[model samples]
Target: MSERLTSVPGLLYGGDYNPEQWPEEVWEQDVKLMREAGVTMVTVGVFSWAGLQPGPDTWDFGWLDRLMDLLHAHGIAVDLATATASPPAWLVRAHPEILPVTADGVRLEFGSRQHYCPSSKAYGQAAVRLTRKLAERYGRHPALALWHIHNEYGDHVTECFCPRSAAHFRDWLREKYGTVDALNHAWGTAFWSQRYGTYDEIEPPRTAPGPVNPTQLLDWRRFCSDALLALHRAERDVLTATSPDIPATTNFMSMMRELDYWRWAEHEDLVSDDAYPDPADPRAHVNASMNYDLMRSLKRGRPWLLMEQAPSAVSWRPVNVPKKPGLQRLWSLQAVARGADGIMYFQWRASRAGAEKYHSALLPHRGTASRGWRETVRFGAELARIAEVAGSRVTAPVAVLLDWDSWWALEGADHPSARMRWPDLMRPWYAALHARGITADFVPPHADLTGYRAVLAPNLHLVRSADARRLTSYVRAGGHLVVGPFSGVVDEHDHLHDGGAPGPLREVLGLSVDEFWPVPDADAVPLASGASATLWSEWIETAGAETVDTYAAGPLAGQPAVTRHAYGSGIARYLSCHLPDHIGDVLDAALAEAGVTACVPVPEGVEATVRTGADASYLFLLNHTDRPVAVDADGTDLLTGAPVRGAVRLPPLGAAVLRRPHSPDSLDSPDPANSPDPLGDNRS
Candidate 1:
């Protein structure tokens, strides 16, 4: 963590504040209200591009200057935006080519946010111009805490098929393959007659015939992510040159499919995620926690910021549901307990009129008298008491492998079936681990695996040679591993591996697949342990592995469904079939074999997570159940500040933070400048 983050007095509360939306009088009232509600900082100028730059080459700073000074006067820090999230009407009118083109070649009209194409030279220059201006103007300002770059990239437009982007994509392809022939070989263009004579012949895989070349699609995804990351890097360089002190970052939509965050994460000084879990799902917290862990893992366990979450209800969903009285508090702390240093919401005061008028905020449209505002105040005050947790980190001995390339390629149209999803399969395993009170970090294929005692890989279908070798080395080095079925079936180029499926891992997995059964037309296939599986079932034969589970009935009757292979001091558990949401019994046995155990067992729907501080580990027990749960643990409960005996009781939607002794000082992170973290020491 940087001093810029830890220098704050407490958890950084508050969020995107639109002082421009209200009158000057209301601005003062909002500041007072924010301070009263324990808001330490606010992100300003997120959507103020149209307002800040009314015309081409025009700049307006009168209203914004006063607001910044006013916020500083009130002792509130500022996460200032360059207001380049959306290009102004005048700029888009002047440079119409900056508008992004859809896959069908339709130019997206202006008025909506993020309409500019990332590869447009004009758009890139204009964005940097505004950003440099902001850095120069507010570099040393008292309230300037951090620099907020352009809002979420590729959220609306993942890739633009415009000529500019196409040219950029071709350039990227040339850089990767060195020659058009090499690219053809990698893409396996033999069957499709896609042999390109020149790099320029390639275009963004846009609206192509029958799903497009899977390799080209994956490359297009890579290009889109790189193009936007290039923009961020350009602005970051400008900011660093002008400011020299302020750290730069952008908010990431945790689970957004566009833009490979695994690659984008390296450019950030510290990671921040905007999460909005569905209230309709009873187990929304599990999904939220998974995203949090992924965000924290982006920086390799560095403290991250909860950039934007709904204070109460979100407006964009089909049906807006208000969070129950204490749900907001429960969710916000959920992020913190999982290694987030700060907690901020989408907005401060609710908008009086706009597209997001219905979106909840610290001070809602109903004003401070409402339940939303009261809960916001209560959560903020609670944050004030726990300021020390800002630099602390949660220690987990398990890692869930996450690969963006694999995710993109695994669900390609040319696959056996499109019924499977990478996140869908990974979520169940993560939830099973989380249920056991064993928090996990999300690791990329290339990340160091020494710290983790075990690694769970749900579906790593698109395995690169180097990465496959890395996994093999990890297993040989005494690291327990769990491999799901249908993995390692394809090389990095999205082509089928030679000979058969489960290519490089055929040796490591100690099994070979002769054929794959698609689970009764995408329905569940019964297993011997009473567990059911969907998506795929591989007819397998083990070389030197032991069968743990088998199919009860089917043509592949009594076949190995799950296998265990011992290598070095570790054991590899391979599930030769897809699994349903419920795999508790199997997961429990796997975890136990790896010597991983939960801090304490809780009733269903209750979560247990541990964050390590300087002198002790803070155990967070969250009760998501409607009924009260009995918790058994030792330590001082932070919520009540009381001692807990043998079995303490927690009400529904309640939480208890337990402080217990552990290895001292858990604050450690790989510096942003360090390309690969070599200090792979496990904290606590």
Candidate 2:
């Protein structure tokens, strides 16, 4: 098996296929129609636990075996599912304790998918049994390209506060801390007389009197995430042992609040994600862009697959809006622009029954004659035109740090303000970078920062002492660092740093935050730089740091609102309030200091991203505005084969791929009538 989906000629384009839902004869027709749309692969058996194993003692693989063989005959590869996403009724009845419990102490009955407790021994045994059975059966199946693990780990049952979970939590704590004393000290258990005499005294943080211990709550989240990850590891190891050549993966949700993806990524051979940006959201592309970038960065800039995206309107939202004409194609290419190797959807054909019956699929209920089917064919054809993009990567000079530990600890129930949303607070920085046409890789806090010219630290509330040292070293060694508000407040253990805010980084930042005020009811305050700030504000005293911006007309009027401190060969800047409207100016100044600038100047709403192949570089231009905008880009438009020299007009919501010629300064003549061979060299 190939490491990536690029084993074939072009970018892999296909989605989930459930043959059990239709007649056996319809499977052939499904394969024929799919091949017509240029699909290369399909993920089967995502939610087929009940269908695959109708009973604990009884097994049925006839339907799936025939389907796989049928797809292989059609030259379509497979991303086979383990059929463990949803347990069958017989298994649940045998071991009722496998059902999960809510934090409110309700034992959820098994009526939906993902109802089993992740930490249940009985459930684990069943998962292992199912995985081994699938691996032995499909170990060398020619159609098998990838192994899809249990679907969406935390989709339904996020956390299980049952007795089984409690036991697992205790075991995990003992392993992580090694000793009870170490655990107590790290948790600062003395705060609320919450110190446990022994490990058995500790229980998963459930309903508590008043506010729960912040340490206990944070640990519970970690434990819950670990439980899910352990399940994936067990199943993944089984498949790898059976067929070491085949890569294993599960569809990860980008913004899932549970099951921290950063921790789960190491277990995956390659990265894959299910992206469902609400069509109703006007800023959906911005959200999708970040997700695509994050997914690519998970494996250090390796190409990933867009496992699930809607071809039309989704049925879940309040007012499920259909995708605007050309929007799906634009979004699909947008993912490719950001380093997605394959484009796939949730279902191959629309569901006629079940929970997601109304979810959009490549083949809608109207079948081959529908607009959804037409768009699928058109997009598939476009992918066929740019096969060189596969195995390539998108690299940038800036990194926006994404720390899951910080997110887990920062906005606990009892903080300066529980309303301080870490995710929302981090969005402005991302949006600012996007608006400037500067692509940034999402990295962990301790990742190598030497490659990036500038690093943005936003709401990094949980930084260990070692992490703080590494960050200071990055800045002192001549890299621009932008520290967002409420950063560096606590250590890795969720305990506040002894002295003040921003802890070990206070000196490098040349400032100290003595007080934090939760002013949710306060209005936006004016910055001396002529911009306004909102939501969060902090009081700080500078220690030899220059005040680049200050509060203009608030209670702390004329005080230092934003400060910059030069340390060694670099500069460290701090923002006391949430990023303001003048953020572009602030970032541009840092970017200029770091010897970097926007990739190229383009009108607002036109997103730009570049993917560099081994022998050529491909630039993707997307026009997101309402009207066609002229771009000062010079390259052969791969879509039309036209050599663009001075300016080209891009239709609204339209996309174009430009493969740059060898000479950066010269625009080579183009063959407008011919499509570039996807496997050929970069030529015009």
Candidate 3:
């Protein structure tokens, strides 16, 4: 077995292949082209359940068998598909109860993927049977490398409101609190004269548009996530029984809402995800990078697979924008640099017809000589060249803490600051770190942060008691901590703690928020740079903590928009307002004072990142803009196959990997201005 196909520290290539869609003649040609492109693995049968199991008892594995055999004969490893994404029409028609009923009381038609009710007994039985059948047949196959469960499990058009799902929701509530009284107390159902006397009286939260209760809607979201996790666990148990050796996983959509990934990761053998961001979007890098970090942290720093990336444009979004030249390669390496062990795209070949005909692939409609094909070849060759060297490398000395409990709590609150939006507040801090090439993991709040020198907690609305203790201890031990404005407002149950703003973190952060000034719009209070903070919402005040910066010109001019607190040997900084470029610079300078250095020393528009291992270090320098950038060379240039003695310029959308000699003290290396570039590319 090749290490590239089955081990850590070796990159795996290739992606979703639908050889069954094309003629047998094209299959051989596809294999030859894949080999030439350095492709090593293929994912099969993701959307083929409708074609495979047409009836409850009927299964046509002939095509799958032949497909696997053909791939195996070519020495291509197979990520065998479970064919559970879309159930067949017969199953839906036979058991109409399996259909999902939306929140609006409309019964969804069985037309797309993820349409089956996860809580339905019929669906579970059928799914388990199909999974067992597939596993029993392919469990002993020599070509099987991994098991890819339902494709992008929660990215579908249905939300279940059927009676079965409602009953499951009730049962889930029972398990969560062990009694209806406890549940009623947590939900505060008595407020609107909505009290449940019996289990049957409780229903999944479904409300029409207008004057709805936020608590009810929040509980419904929580219940639905739990109900779906049960389905995942059931399927996982079936596969684990049949083929215990093979790893099983479902692809996650980055930063998705419906499914609780932290809980889902507990049942998966490995984490995998699909990433598709708009090419023209300015926040594309942060969006993709945050998702990669979230996936990596889900398994506690374990490597994950980039299961489905767009080789070009995706067809589903209203606007299908193509990735610019070198963009795909940059994003692929971004995943690997973050901690991905494998890189693959959605479709290996362009579909001749259907919903995704416009999706990009290695071999476009014009065949192998086109721009898409050439870019794929170049990316593949580069991946193969560094496949062995870049495997299993980890990056960064700092990590950011992210918690699902906090996410749920923030959204679950009835009195949540209308001004606070979680994603918007978190993105800027994440982007600031990414621009400097720092690799930060998104660990849960409960994760141990003792190893990290700095911890950034953005919009930490929910603060558990234990987490507060841990954070206090971390800061007291000389570690730096950053807390965003709306942090520490609620407890685990989404209720105000009655102490003050920030609850338990109030004492640790040495700040108590007395009032919040909600800006009417981005123009209401602009940054010092004269740019409006587009998504900024609330500006808070610290009653006791020392003010670091105030609004430059506004009605609340001298109010504390940013504060700092001294806690033992360390310091805690609280950001109260949405900081545009000017305020962001002040915050960045504050972080520098706390002993955190920029991951890369380049100017804006150029993205810098570093990945390291015990024996090697790799620095990534990328130009994110359309125009070229002149960068000072620092080490051996892996992409250009040359080293520069001083300043070097990179073309538009260019990227390079600089390999530096490893040292045990690399993490503690002094300022770059004092240390010479060991590879003779120093710049004065």
Candidate 4:
């Protein structure tokens, strides 16, 4: 047994393989095609609970054993799943209580996947039993490389309102708070005369006439996340105990709010993510890069795996647009540009029957003669050319702050505005950095910020005293800090801070918010800096900070819209309104002040990133436009044997991974006159 995912050379390339769906005769052809595609590994038995166990007393491992042997003979590794993602009809019929209940009090039947309750005792016991069974049988199997616990934990059933879940929620509350009095105080139950007398009276925030207590809803979300995490831990413990050398993991949906990936990453030996960036979105690459950066930062810059993606169009979305020619290869390399050790997809072959029958796969229904199959083979060969990129790390000098607790708190029912979506507000900041060719890593509020030159907190709406202290200490220790609007307004318990807005951060920022003025009905507030803001505005009365920008024409015309405070050895900047246009200026000023430079200068749509290894550094330049763009570089392109001297012209949707043996200074930005026109129309 090996600790890593595979022992073969090069980056892993493969997808989920369900051998049971096809006849035994087709399995040989599948392995031959896998070898041709340069696939080193494949995930097996993800949704095979029914086939693996025909009945409670009857067991069938003959088919799995033969498939494992067949794959091993063909020199392909296996990421064997525990086959507990979807329960069989027998289990559900035996204990119908295992089925999840919606908030509207409807017991959901079990036709689709992920239909079990997170807190069901019966379900947990059965899942653990199956995990132990698999581990015991495959502990010494030659093809086993990694153990995938279960498929996407909180995808369909994030929270359950059944009686079993209510009981589990009560138990979780007791463990977290220890007493009814403590729970009431933490939840602020005194509001709306909703104080509880005992723990037995608590429920899972079921459907109510009026709005439920905000804190209660927050706690319910926390408990639901924890309940799902407990299931993963239970199954993971069996595998680790059975085969300690083999690492265990479960696929994570990128930026999923249901389960906290930061907390979940702590339990994983290797982090793997499933990302689907819509092809219809023109700027989908920008947001997809943000998720990739988050995956890299989850385990502190460890190289993770891209578990699932569509080779072409996906079947789920309404429109279901196909990935344009060369788009899949471009985005796949983009993942490698960030930090993905392996590239995998949902299914190896297209499904002939099922809900996802129309979903794209490496081997489409047209088989080996189709363009999709040709592209798949080409992509695999491209991955083989850059095998040295494995085990390298990407270091970022700038960090963007994201906290799950804050995200759960900010999106409650009763808020200042219904338009304050976390992802929408945070994407702009990341896009600003991306457009400037500045690579950034996502960090939590309490993460170690000493390594970063600047830290951007786009929206930390819920911050406790400890989180505030960490930010203050980071700024005092010579790190630039940027605080966004509607931040520091509430504590961890969903209770408002006593001192007002920017509560614990008031002293560091040197300002206090008088009131939040959310602009109504498509109105823009003009700023003295010649830029306009929309959606949100805050009235601030600075005590010791300098006003950098102010409201130009409004009731609070002379009020400060942006302020800067000089702390111990650094500066703290605050934006009181949502700056849709001028955010780049604010971030550029901060980056200049902190002495942070971009990796390289390129055209507007081009992306630049670097991955450093023990012996060499690789610079990735991706041209994401319809025309060729020129880039200055001096290295060998790994994709091609050609040597790049002064500059290289990349064709439309082209990519180049340059291997630099020495001279790290090549990453520094060139002089203004020598640099390429960043916003010019470089139409080749």
Candidate 5:
């Protein structure tokens, strides 16, 4: 068997296909249209648990068998789902105890999907049985390309405060900490007299009067993620045992805080994600790029798949906004530019009736003449033209640190300011880099930073001693480092460091935080560098560093707001305030210090990325603005097969993929970049 999961020859293109929803005559038309749209793969049976198994023992595979056979005959492959995403009403009605209980002690009903608790034994066993049956029936089918595990693991319900889940949490705690004394030490239970004498005393951190124990809340978050993962593993084991060669995957909600993807990615044969960037948000593409980078980085630069995206507008948002004329193709190609091996969507055909009836699809309600259908056909043709870029790689010189543990702890209750969101602080830094045409990868705090020119930790509220040591060594070995506010403040156990804030990183950062003065919402304070800081500011006393900037107003006036220190062979810069407006300036200095530059400079609002294969490198340029722009390049425009010498012109909301002879850039030699071209003629 091949190492790759998708057995298709070129870049895979398709979406979720539900033959059961439509009549038998419509199935024929769907297959014909799939061929016309150049779709090679489709996800089947995602939410078909009810239809597949009407009762506890009854089974129905006649319709599914025919659909599978029809799809195979038409040359379309199947990423078959285990069909356990949502349990059937029969199962839930029979075992009402399996329903999830919210923290308020109300058992949720089964009107919506994903109503079962993660720790419910009845749910897990039923999911495993169905997965095993599917694997046995279609394991050797020619159309079976991949096995999709439970769809979007933690999308609707992440945590369940029911008695079953509470028991599972206690079991998990027992395994992690052998004794109650150790658990008390880890949770710092001495503060509120919340010490635990036995594992049975601990619960899932249900609703409390004032504030829950921070450490218990953190552990609850951890347990919730693991519980869902355990459920996935149960079904995965069945699939793998039945069809060992076929790869298995589950679609991840991009950057979801409910599950720790880094830990979950370890079990996946192929990393895949479902991305839905709002059409209303102008800067949505920037955040999407970060999410795409995280997906690729989950498997250490291995090529991943774009499991699902909106063809146009999504129904879930308050104000549903449709994609403009060329916006769909532009954003889809952006995923390829970031590192997606394939592009797929949430659905194939628009539903006639459902909660998602308004969600856009490849074959819309207006049929072939619709703008969405026409655009889909055109985009599929374009993907086929540049199929050679499928297995290519993207490389980056910088890494942004992301840790789910820190995210859970930082966003928990009783912090310096509730206004300080993890992603809010991260977006400005990443957006600055995207604007600079510089690519970056998201890595864990303990990830190896050997090849990266510079590393940035936006906020590591929870850092382990080992992670701090690795970072210290990286800086000592001539790697530029930048750490944001409130970092190194606590250990993994959520206990404050001995000296103060910036615990283990104090020596490397060359400063100590005396106090955290968080400004009120919509308030700003003056900085000595002429840039105003908002949301967060810290009083600092430098140990062995040079003060870069100081607060000019407020109680912390004249105090250092930003500082730089000379470590072993490199420099460590610290930003002690929320400086979204001036992050680009700080990053520019770090880039200069680390000798990192953009892959190829382009005009503002134009995105530039490169993917390198063994023989050649492909340069991708995307014009995100409403006007045409020219970017310097030298190679063949893969979309048109036209040779380019100097520059390539991209129209409004346009893109270009140029295939050139490979030239190894030293900084990103080990990392990889994402996907391709838009124009037919070379006219710069």
Candidate 6:
């Protein structure tokens, strides 16, 4: 199965198909239409639990059998569903403990998918039984290309406070800290009058107004994440025991707060995600770019599937905003530019009733006669044309260090500042790279850094000794390293390392931080480029670092907000403030000094991305705006099959791919003087 998938030309094209919702006669028509549109796969049984097992004790496989047989008779492969997204109504009613408990201690009713209690014994047992049953029945089937686990786990509100959850939390604590004393020290319960004499006394943190304990909330988040992972593992173990060759994956919501996907990535055969960008929002590129990097990095540069993107607009979101013309196809190509192996939509055909009835689909309510269908066919044709050339292409030379343990450790600390949010600190640097047409892979802190030329670690609050050594060696070998301010404050156990700010990394970074300035009420700090920026806090370096930039005009004026240190033939740059556009120029200069630059030329309000393989190179030029712009490049336009010798005009929100001849010096050929400078634009 893996070999077959790897040998496929370009990205796989297909999506979710629910034949149980329609009559048997309609199935043939649907298959005919899908083949006409170049669909090669169909996901089955996503929301079929109600149909598969109508009662608590009885199970039926007749409908699923017919559906699978029909799909296999055609040439379309199948991503077999686990049917565990939602339990039958009888099972939920019979075992009420399966329902989830909210953070406020409220038990929810069983009405929606992903509402099952993670810690419930009955729920876990039932899920395991059903999963094994399904695996045993169809694991050896030839058409099963992948194992699709329960759909989109942990999308709703999280945290369970029931008796089962409480007991599991106690057990998890025992395994983590071994004793109450160690737990107390890590959580810093001494200041809150919340010292625990016994494990049973611990409780999940409740939302309140002031001075809440960060450690307690952090542990609760970790516990919730682990609980869901256990559910995933339970299902995966059963599937693998039966069908070891089929890849197993659960579709993830990118950067979701409830489940830590980094931890979950270790258990799956491959990573898959659902991406739905808000069309009304102007920063859709920023959001989509972040998720693409995240998905790619989850498997350490292995290709992942875009499991669920709306064909047009989603019905569940309030207002049901439609994707502007050309945006859907552009976004699909954007996914390929990152590292998606397959592009699939949520629903192949729009539903006639239910919560998602209004969701747009390839075959909309008007069938194959409307603008939606026309666009779908056009995109399908485009994909077929480029399929042979785009397959197996890789992106980027730069890497970003993302530590899951670091994320957990920082959020678990007993810090004094309320403004230190993790995502806000990481987003700026990520956006900086994306705006420059550079693809940055999100690597785990402990990952091998032998091939990368530049490394960016943003808000890496936790530092492992082994990872520090690797970074040191990479720098010593003449690789660039960029470490942000809130780094190296804690260890894996969420406990302070204690020597100085940045702890173990201080030696490698060559800086000794004295204190951090928690800017509580300061307005946006003006930059030299006439832009203002806001930051949560800025680190005040007292000694042992060269100041690169300072606050332009404020109480902190003339104080260093950015610093750089030379170490072993390489350098380390530390950004101390929330960077505005002006600071991006400084970052670009640093990147240039390190002998790395953006892959393509970027225009204002346009996204420039590059994907390359052994025999072909693709340059994606995307205009992410409402107005048209002129673009000029030196290559053959892939879409038009014509030589692009000079300036080319682009329409509003349009995209074009240039198929340049592949060579060792292709990246270096576009001279800085002739190319549009990415750092000159600040719109992103």
lDDT of each: 0.83, 0.84, 0.73, 0.88, 0.89, 0.75
Clashing pairs in 6: none
Best by lDDT: 5
lDDT for each residue of candidate 1 in 313-431, tens digit (9 for 90 to 100): 89999998988878998888899888888998989988988789999888888898898888888888888877766666766778888888888888788567777689888888988
lDDT of 5 by residue, 1-684 (tens): 232447888889999998888999999999999999999999999999988898999999999999999999999999999999899888998999889999999888998889989999999899999999899999999999999998999888998999999899999999999899999999989988998888889988888888999989999999999999999999889988999988899999999988999889989999999999998999999999999989888877767999999999999998999999999999999998887889999799999988999999999989998999999999999999888888777878899999999999889888889987899999899999999999988888777777788999989888888788888988999999999998898888888888988999998999899888898988998998898999999988999989988999889889999899999998999999989989898889989999999989999899999887767888888889999999888899887889888999889998888997756565434423322111112211
Model 6's TM-score against the true structure: 0.90
Which digits, one per residue and each the tens of the lDDT, describe model 6 over residues 88-127? 7888889888888876778888776767888888878888
Q: Which candidate should be chosen as best, given TM-score against the real structure? A: 5
**Cα deviation of 158 in candidate 1 (Å)?**
1.1
Question: Residue by residue across 245-292, what tens digits does model 3's lDDT show?
Answer: 878888889888677777788787788889997897977977888898
| Cα error, candidate 5, residue 39 (Å) | 0.4
Show where candidate 3 strays beyond 4 Å.
1-5, 208-213, 412-419, 526-544, 551-557, 580-583, 633-636, 640-649, 663-684
Candidate 4 residue 631 Cα shift, in angstroms, is 0.9
Q: Candidate 2, TM-score vs. the true structure? A: 0.95
What range of 10 consecutive residues in model 5 has the weakest lDDT sum?
675-684
lDDT of 5 at 104: 95
Model 1 clashing-pair count: 0
Off by over 4 Å in 2: 1-3, 661-684
Worst ten in a row by lDDT for model 6: 675-684
Going through the candidates in order, what is the number of backbone clashes in each?
0, 0, 1, 0, 13, 0
